[model samples]
Target: EPEVTQTPSHQVTQMGQEVILRCVPISNHLYFYWYRQILGQKVEFLVSFYNNEISEKSEIFDDQFSVERPDGSNFTLKIRSTKLEDSAMYFCASTKTGNIGYTFGSGTRLTVV
Candidate 1:
């Protein structure tokens, strides 16, 4: 089975720095998304994408965050300015349809210090 791939499995950046988390979801999937899990907290939805546009986003995905599917293959989440509270395990997920059979990337761990 194909898998969603994330780069730089772990990253540590100082507060205020910019960071871009990258992901490559299964090629045939139609929906892609991002979510984060703070060290001890449940997963928090960040954003969702479809047809080259942001289909939906949560409050946490504020001005400081952005997502793009550059080149139609690379899905990326950019944090314009890092904050201590932004530290978390960021996951990438995709599905052929929006409602079922989701496949998730291992995750990129962000550590904002």
Candidate 2:
């Protein structure tokens, strides 16, 4: 079975630098989402994309963040400027429909130093 893939399982970046987390969603999946877990906090939704447009985005998805489908199978989330608070486990997920549970990647662990 196909699975979502994320790179650099752990990332340590400076507070002012930029970081791009990469993901390859499951093949044949049409909906993609990005979520984050701040250490012990609950999972929070960042953004969701479909049909080449953002379907929804939470307040956390500010100007510093952007997402793209760089190619047929790759999705990316770029943080233009990092902050200490931005450190978290960022997970990429995809599902064929909203009614079903999502399949999440192992997660990219971002650490702002």
Q: By lDDT, who's the top model here?
A: 1
Q: Cα RMSD (Å) per model?
A: 0.6, 0.9
Give one digit per residue, the lDDT tens place, for model 1 in 35-108: 99999999999999999999999999999999999987889999999999999999999999896998999999
lDDT of 2 by residue, 1-113 (tens): 78999997999999999999999999888999999999999999999999887899999999999999978899999999999999999999998886376899999999999
Q: By TM-score, who's the top model here?
A: 1
Candidate 1: lDDT over CA atoms? 0.96
* Per-model TM-score on C-alpha atoms: 0.98, 0.97
Clash pairs of candidate 2?
none
